[model samples]
Target: MTSPPRRLPGEGTAHTVEQSAGELARLAMARMDETLGWYRELSAAQRSQVGLVAQAGISQFVEWLRQRERHAPSAISIFANAPQELTRAVSLRHTLDLVRTVVDVVEARATSLAGPGDEQLVLESVLRFSREIAFAAAEVYAGAAEARGAWDARLEALVVDAVLRGEADDSMQSRAAALGWDDVAGVTFVVGRAPLAASSPDAPAATVDSLRRAARHLGVEALAIVQRDRLIAIVGGTRDPLPVVEHVADRFGPGPVVVGPTVPHLFAAGRSARAALSGLTAAVAWPGAPRVVESDELLPERALAGDLPARRRLLDRAHRPLTESAQSSQSPLLETATAYFEHGGSLEASARALFVHPNTVRYRLARITDVTGYDLTRPRDAWAVRVAVTLGRLGGTGATPGPAVGLSDAGQPAPVGRRGLEESSNL
Candidate 1:
């Protein structure tokens, strides 16, 4: 083509460099546009996060352009007249720089999400990341009117999550402060239980979700936390522990349920709940049906209740040895002796109580000394024998221990017994 006008080799190299630079500039502009689009999709917290990075990137890009202006080629004037193109180039360069910084922030936040030690900090970090993501997405969706609706929805979600976390934290702090953790408080109740294995098809998700839904149904607002195959909930604003315990048991099934005592406030509630759980564990292990247990209910009988079968556990632990000893059993002597001894060593009373002859009651009282070498005449051992026998009769088999399965206020058997015992106790 006319010898190509005899162009120099250096001219070809310069032209190639200009073309490469223009392509880089175009790519930078595209990135800026994409970033702006992403920004609109971000939440308030996310916008704040990206805003810092955006400022730094913009500053660097401006300084770079100013430096380049001193040596800019004459042909670059063409872009000068194209303000839109120039603006896009500047925006893109800034966004690219910010993206690098944002990546680092996101990674750090994700890492900390697993085990953020301070509860408050954990909440704050969630808010911070939410903000970052919202802002980044907004940058990506910037100036795209047709797709703006979709980005707006996403941004709304991000903002909601950020705000919700902050509210939850503030609410927690306020509740804590009021409970006198700000001053002082007693044991904390940490109410929780390990979730049982899913019972049926669709039960796992269905059970948990149903419980959450039911809280609303019951007009109860509380936090539901799932941890280690367990659902833990903290409830505030109620002094009546019984109703809540009943309500939860009714909802969650009867598997070893426990309700901790209401402490002075929320701060101490965690400890109280843990203690209550321990009692529930012991009760479930004790025997009988799945029962809702309480900490205070078990304290009286815990001492000797350790390994006895359910029927015998409460009686045996609450008193001294009541049942027949092995040697005394050979002669029916210990049982007879205990009965007579429990009758205040009164032959007539012991006979009437046992539906036996007074002679037989006296004869057994004599054998008590022979079999175990315990003189029923001694006041202390006689008292022990009396209490033990009473407990045995109270907790005897072929009978129910009444509905008083839990601890009494004084760490004693619940004052209310059944039948004659119940009637007499009531009197």
Candidate 2:
């Protein structure tokens, strides 16, 4: 009885908007194609998503008018019907432009689409709805950005793991390409103990993010991750990478932060990774080493700790080149170096032992540096020369007791002790 008594007049503006929804959506799309350059460039599927969004906007405005008295509609729900690819294919700015286009179409047709007394009301409602929808679009984009960031982080970790494991095959390379690391050249690898994060569970990721932000200022590309207690980073520097590494060294944990040599490209970065890993393990031997020392500087410790690559590097750079310099004497510089180190790096003692004058010993020391790049006066350089020369002798003697492998300080034959004998046999 009450329902039949006095039925209020239909909401004219809401009815008109509902009737014109299909046409208004078409007009909005047409206007977008006419005005927005980026919109025209979109693929067919993306364009279809844009159409769905425009149609939804008109329908939502009608619903808002009808249901607003009891429950205000969430303008955000206007985008609920849109596909996920809509957000990815269309940027926030582009989406806002589309929304503005829909609003413009509706406003331009307000006079014709509304009942006589409802035109101004429809126009005002459109203004308010657009403002709310703009905010809703921004919130949607914020969520997309958050999701994209997490996915990119996981992808970066995969690329780094692949590179470190020397699995730089096509599959890994494709993944790197997805991360925009395909064309990068001259990548440097850095290794150190991951910082303790007792105060925060997310310290490692935060530290890595901070490091990457710092590196970006230098125009460097950085990919870093923390694996348990080990922090590994692969840095791509266009200029001298050492300066960038030096600038970022304070970010690492309290331990040796070893930087490896640069390789030609990311595909070849495993070589650098190996060296950095070996240097990090061997760094404990040199308590006085710099916190950000190059892996090459730790060659002596690495070679001594059974890193075959380091041993081969020392032999090739110093022993082989020095021996090659003397075709007749088989590395006379070798004997000069042997005497210098055996006498506690004393030039006079080395001269007395080699039966040469002090000046001749001094001249030979300069030649040693020229041939081997290791200065005998520097303790680290002396350590490297000792290891290289010892490896050279042991490598050459092969199951035979030789004086070269165990030379006394007096430049005479010394006994190959039980330890030396056992060590030499393995070589």
Top-TM-score structure, candidate number? 2
User: How far in Å is the alpha carbon of 46 misplaced in model 1?
Assistant: 17
Model 2 clash number = 0
* Candidate 1 residue spans exceeding 4 A from truth: 1-209, 250-254, 300-427
Q: Write the per-residue lDDT of candidate 2 for residues 253-280, one digit (tens) a residue.
A: 8888999899888898878887887788
* CA-RMSD of model 1: 22.7
lDDT of 1 by residue, 1-427 (tens): 3333211223333333233443433443344446556555555555444454444332332232223232212222222233332233334444444454443333343333233333343234334433443454344436433243333323322222222222325544544343222333332232335446443434444444555465545654333333333344444545555555456654454365555666665444534543453455455544642355555444333322432232243344333332444344344654666666656677788778878898876676666556444556675446444544555565555433332244443222222222322221110
Summed backbone clashes in each candidate are 39, 0
Evaluated at residue 77, the lDDT of candidate 1 is: 24
- Distance from true location, Cα of 84 in model 2, Å: 2.9
Q: What is the TM-score of each candidate against the true structure?
A: 0.31, 0.81
Candidate lDDT scores, in order, read 0.42, 0.77
